[model samples]
Target chain A: MQAIYEYLFGAASFVPHGYCLAWRPDLIAIHALSDGVIAVSYFSIPIALILLLNKREDLAFKRTFGLFALFIFACGVTHLTGMIMLWEPYYGAQGMIKLMTALISVITAISLWPMLPKVLALPGPSQLRAMNERLADEISDKNEAQIQLHNAYSQMEAQVVARTRELQEVNQRLKEDVQRRTLLEEELREKAELLTATNAELERFAYVASHDLQEPLRKIQAFSDLLKREYENDLPEEALQYVLIMQNAAHRMNKQTKDILTLSRLSWDSIKFASVDLAEVVEEVEFDLAERIEESGGKLEIGDLPLVPGDRTQIRLLMQNLLVNAFKYRAADSTPEVKVNATLHERGAPGTGGAYVELTIQDNGIGFNQEDAERIFSIFQRLHGRSEFDGTGIGLAICKKIVENHNGAIEAVSSRGEGAIFKIQLPTSQPTRRNNDAGRNEAI
Target chain B: MQGVTKRFKVLMVDDDPEDGVLVQKAIASAGHKVDFQVVTNGAEVLDYLFTEGRFTDQSRAPRPNLILLDLNMPGVDGFTVLKQIKSNMDLRRIPVVVLTTSEAETDIVKSYDIGANTFITKPTSFADMIEVMKSLKKYWFDSAQLPVA
Candidate 1:
């Protein structure tokens, strides 16, 4: 070891260290200052590098930065050794430091060659800024889409709320309408019941009044007739004439009361509907009017008549009234010719399948004026004086009542000095009682 | 008239005196040998038929051959009287006729339903009343046979 050291420091000293440099005090001071400054700067550089490494813990290639810092420190130490050689020949140490610096330099250079591509592949500042700008743009577009979706959701919610409110209002209106209709129906039912009661009461009053009225009138007629029968010779001519007038008035009043009673009793009780042969009714009526027909020289002809639904008694009365009217209204010169005919017809709308039997009684008699046709059906409505006709003028009215009771209709067609036709239409099948009751209520 | 040697005793039950008098006159005019006795009200007629109250004397209230009843009265109307008479064994043999001013069909049907022998509506005129009475006399006193009391 001593030999090797002697070889490095004895004659192999390339520049005889400090003597070859011609070292003056000024040069020595300058070199020492320069070396001191470089040494300090180098140490400071390493300290700064360590501090930076500590602060930037994420710094890339940390091993390479550490190696560069160690090399620079070795160079500053070599400079310090050069300054020491001017004073003492520590040539061996100086040589060793220089060699160490050369070795570090060579190692740093070789390590840098392999790290070149890695450093070049890293992103530069401009490239990183451009990528950040693109990310910001994408985030902005996503935010815009989210805002549009939120707005659409809010609009749909608002429409749903509005539709729900509108439906609630319509439902409220429908509820009110249903309530109003129910109230109206209740009122109508009450009114119908009241009207039915009133009609029954009126019918009862009519029946009672007619019946009571007939009682007193009968007494007057009976007593008056008794007086006339037993004491006619005792009375003066004028008094006898007065008695005759009284008798006539009483008889007329009695007839009127009886006719009123018949009219009132038409619908006084429940009707029993049955199928009646109209031909049989006509025959019975003809039998009842036989004497009158013979006296008036009236010729009666009957055609085909149908069996109709009606009350048997009421139909007989209706036929009697019509026949009596025919016989009573005969012409003064011509023989009364009466013809009765019937036909079946469809009633109401065509497809309804409702049918009726129409009976037409045509007469060759002293027909009334057409204007009085409607008036003739009114009770006690006389067209001629008592001298011209001996009737209470209630026969047609009774006929009309009977026809209405059977759910039938009667119409008269006549002209002055012409024949009259009484057309009667009766339903073949009885309408329901409810329909008849409704019709009666309307008439009342 | 067969089996009518004695005059027919008729009891007329009425509410109105004028109606009762008129019925008597109509019967007389019908040429019937009838002795008519009038009771003013339906209750009095019942009393006479049962021989009770004011009609306790059997000789004065003899059994009538025919009883003419009026339906509408102040008390115990003709329907009740007829019911009572037909239910009693002693009075049921007498023929009861309903002679009323009521022309209502219900009255006629009810009278016949309660064992009335005949039903007749009182005519409004004296002539018509006489005719009806004549028919009644012909049917009851002349044609119809009566049970011996």
Candidate 2:
């Protein structure tokens, strides 16, 4: 049975049914190879399209390019499988046909390898055009947004300009207001100065007028008193007593007027500075008041005094007045020990740069009440009666003025019937002090 | 007046004309024949001395031997005038006595500093003024040497 079948099929089964189908095996092999080639080509085209679509990322291209190359080689394998299957059967009978089929299939598959990458380079034209249109729309939208922002910037610029103009106007108004205020202040200051000057002039005129008036009044009082003294019996006693009272009042007025004139003169003259020796001045004062000092039994001890810069004669007057007061009001039976001492007090104060020479005149005299200490320096202020202590009542006031003229201060510390210490602090060579040095001895 | 050095010429510089008249009377009362030249203020004193303004007749307005300077004169007080006269080399030779109402010690010292021959407080009593005038005659004419022009 096997022999009969072999004769009828003419070795078709043994050689391969694919070979019998071909009058030429090469043609048959060509046909079989074409099937695998077409399939692999179609498959490779899809793979290349996927690779191209995913080629944007560097990592995607690295992974996908290798797969694409492998796909091409896989296509080559389909043709290789057909050629190998036909090779074993036709190795002796039709070797050229097998070899030729394999060679042609391989050449076609290999040729498709590079062409697949070129065919799938980018997307189709319609899809790319659609993407470009979408991108153009997005850019146009951005441009519209920029135009809106530019309009907003212009509006903000207008607002800023308006704000700047408002601020400038405000500044101008403020400057004008300041100028007006300054002018007003200047006018006010000038008016104040004029008022002060006018007041001073009026006071001076009044003083002079009253002082001159007193001279004529004095002659009247003197003549009237002379008439009363000369013709006492010729006039009534009541009339004589009235005339005496009138004379006394006139004398009091004269004294008051003289004191006022003296005070006015002191204020009118400006103070000046010069080298003044207090020791010499005190010695002269002692000589002048020798009788009073001797009669009162007051011991005047003037110690070493520093020479300072001041009005010399004024300081002399100051010393004279203070000494007179001490002698005039001595403690009963106390021997009236008046010690005049001066020492440069080294305060070493900040900003004062050292010492202040203070002339202290302390006296064991019949001191006044504590209340009178401050009041005694005032003009026409007296603690005692004219009968008890004869004075113009302006002595201490004049003393204060003289001391003040020397840029010095006089203060009295006293207790009733105990004693009194008058401290006179005068600034030394203020010329040597720096600009900022307000004298330490300026404290009154 | 005959025995005394040929009736001394006197110049009184005062702000008040009435005061000037009073000074003239006072100078005349001493029995000395004093040709007293009166100027209203310190300005007139300068005008008379320097022969400026109204006082152009230099020879007619003879230079006075004594100047009785009242300190409170207007338009240039006696102090200012005194300072100018005492400092001037041409005029400093003349003796100046400061006659003013102020008895301030400072004024007294200042007058001496500015070359004033003497500083005398104005006495309220005319009798005291006469005494001052007598002393002035004794000191300037009898005691001190009088400068001859």
Candidate 3:
């Protein structure tokens, strides 16, 4: 232990560089400053490497950086020894430090020789910069994608708002339409009720008026007749003439009132529709007008008549009126001839389908002017004065009303000094709804 | 008024006095020995028939062989009177003829439905009325057999 200690501490064994040369302070200071500066630089470099290694934990080739740090520390220690030798002549210490330095340099050199390829393979600063640029571009692309996704979400939200508004508008319009339809239906119902009430009132008025009017007219006729019969011998010639006129007027008025009542009764009266044989109606008319026909010496000719849908009583009345008119208007020279015939008329275009029965009552009598043919159907319308024709002028009007009630039409063709033809068209089937309403209004 | 042989009694029901008078004159002119009694309205006719109210005395209110009913009356119409008379077993035997100014088919139909014996419109002229009365007398008094009073 004494010998080892003597060998390690023996500081006078070697000469110092400063003892062999002139003691130049400036050179020594310069050398010492350089050694100190080199030592400090080496020491600082190793500390920086340690800190860099700690911070860059993910850096590759970590062991290589550790080896480099050790080598730099050894170099810093050798420089520190050189700075000490510059002050004191410690040649043994210097030689020892140099020997350690040489040993560390050899280890470092050998270690570096094997790691040359690894060091070359390691990415350079420029390559790392290029990779970092790519990483930054990827990050930017991801950010752009996130922004676009946000924009799409916002646009979708806006579209949803617009769609919601449109749906709300459609729903509003549907609600309005429903309200309008309900209102219109209610209005139509109210109008229909009002029309029905009016029709009923009018019917009642017609019935009462016609019924009450007959009573007074009957009394007038009765009392006038009583006056004429009770005062026949007491009255003078002129007074008797006046009485005759009064009687004639009263009789005409009574006939007119009766005719008016019959017309008014047609409005409220309900008639049963049945299959009426025209031949039967004609036979009844002939029987009813037998007296008139015999007085006029008229010959009645009957032909084949079809069965038609109509009211039996109305048709009988219709035939009676036409036949009576024929006998009443006979010529003074010729005997009256009345012919009744019926033919089937196809309605609408030829061969189309529906048919109606047409009854033609031709008369060889003193026919009126052709202009008066249509005018004869109007109530109380007469072409001749009461003196010329003895009638209430309501017979043809009644005939017209009866035909209309059966949903039929009556037309006359006549010329002065010539015969007259009364053509009546009757439906083969029951009247259609429109025709039925028209017939009802015509009754009113 | 003591009768030789009780003539055919007729109770004429009418609202108008003039019509009643005319009908009486017509029956008299027709030369029929009809014991015509005039009642002002349907109520009076009912009183005369059932011997009630003013006609409670049996002698004055004789059982009518025939009733001539007017349709349009103030208190009780002819249709109701006809229905009431026909429904009553005692009064239904008396033939009730409808004599009115109404020639409406409804009036005739309703009168017949209520058991009216016959329906006739009162003629406007006196001569026509006389003729109708003659026919009525011939058919009701001369031809028809009445129930025992």
Candidate 4:
């Protein structure tokens, strides 16, 4: 131990390094300058490494860099020992510094060589430039894709707006159509109400004509008859004739009033609809007027008849009036002959509705003038006096009313001394909600 | 009416005075020996039937075996009076015959619907009126087994 300590600090027994240069002043001076320069260069490199390590602590092989700095510092110390030995005979310290430099160099090489592949595995400048170019291209591609996505989003929003606008327009059209339909329905309801009012008025008039007005006529006829019967022997012949004439007039007036009432009672409101076979109705009417028809020497020629939508009683009344008219208006020379037939008529006009059943009643009777054809359907439109044919001139009028009540049309064509042809068109099927109003027809 | 001795009481309702007089005369000649009474309005009919007001006396308001009702009147019409009489337990048994000058179908149907035993359209002729009265007496007083009043 004493020897090793003497060797490590053996400067007391060693000569100065200037003796190895044989005491040549110029050589020693040159060696000292060279070592001084090398020492300063080595120390400056270590300081630069330390400064780089302090600033870039994240550099790879940081411990290896510290080892490299220690190696360089040891080399700098050896160079300084060389420079110091030339002046201060510190050969032991110079050799120890050289040994430390060698040891530090060995450690730096051991650490640095193990990490050589890792340090070289880092990207070179050209590879980093290529990666930067590739990342730039990818960024541009992403930017383009984002632009396309934005355009698609905008387009989708625009389509939604257009669709919303179209739907709004359709909704508006539907709203307008609904409003128009509501208005049309309201108008139809108002017209129906007006028709009901007119029917009520007609029923009231018929009631007054049938009941109140007939009472006075009845009383007139009754009182006059009683006076004539009770005072026949006491009264004068002319006075009795006057009473008889008055009674006859009253009776005629009463018949006229009753016919008017009948015609007016065929109001549109009091219609009860049923599927009535016209043939059956005609048979019933014929049965009712059998005596009259036989007395007039009239014959009925009934053809195939169809079932019509109508009130049975009203249709019977129609057939009866028409048949009576035929039998009553017969020629004085020739007997009456009546033909009744019905035909199916399809595709009627809009005013007449869908389909129709056309009935024709032809009669060989004494006919009226052409101008009176239309007027025959009017009330109290008699062609002859009451004595000629005992009628109140309301038969045709009542028939027309029956036909009109059944949503039908009636017309007559005739000539003087010729037969008459009556055409009646009726709807095949009646509307279900027909004439539902209960009219105010009261006995006065 | 052929062999029975008890006289049948008949109540006639009429608005017209002449018509009432004619009915009374016709009933007199009907030969049924009917105790006939006449009232001008439907109120008097109820009054007489219920024996109220002036007809509170039993002698004045004798219950009739038959009631001849006039349909049309100025106040308390025949329909209202008939409804009351038919609904009443005491007066419902009496056979009510509705007679009216107005021979409308509505009046006839309403009369029958209101429980009239017979609906008679008043005849215009006096002879026809006499015939109606005779037939009414024969049907009500003789033929029909009416509830005793």
Residues A1-444, model 1: lDDT tens digits: 888777556545455345655866677778778888988898888788888999999999898888888888888898888777667676777888899999998888888889999998887788778877877887888788888888888888898899889899989999999899899889998888888778767766877787778877887887888888768899988988998898889888888878777777775755667789999999989988889889888889999888997788888988888878777787687889899999999774122347888899899888989999999999879888889888888788889988887667899999977889999888787743313333442221
DockQ of 3: 0.76
Query: lDDT per residue, candidate 2, A1-444, as tens digits?
Result: 765544443334455535556547677767667856765775677477566666646443443444445555555555555454453342332344445545655665676676677658766688788878888888898888888888889989999999999999999999999999999999999997787677567657656865676656655564564466458899998999888887777767777777667565555554456677888999999999998789877689889977887666567878888888887786456788888999786664224545666788888888978888889999778888877877778878887876665556788999989889898777665543121112123332
Native contact fraction per model = 0.70, 0.00, 0.75, 0.50
lDDT of each: 0.82, 0.71, 0.80, 0.82
- On DockQ, the leading prediction is 3
Query: Ranking under DockQ, best-scoring first?
Result: 3, 1, 4, 2
Q: Which ranges in model 4 have alpha carbons more than 4 Å from their true place?
A: A1-203, A349-353, A436-444, B1-3, B25-33
Give me the overall lDDT of model 2: 0.71
Across residues A154-240, which tens digit of lDDT does each residue of candidate 4 receive? 999999999999999999999999999999999999988888887677667675767678887877877786787668899999999
DockQ of 4: 0.51
Work out the iRMS of candidate 1. Answer: 1.3
For model 2, the superposed segments whose C-alpha errors exceed 4 Å read A1-17, A20-42, A45-55, A61-64, A71-73, A76-268, A331-334, A348-354, A402-408, A431-444, B1-120, B140-149
Clashing pairs in 3: none
Please give, for residues B47-130, the per-residue lDDT of candidate 3 as tens digits: 888889998999999888888999988979888889889999989988989998777777888888889989999887888999
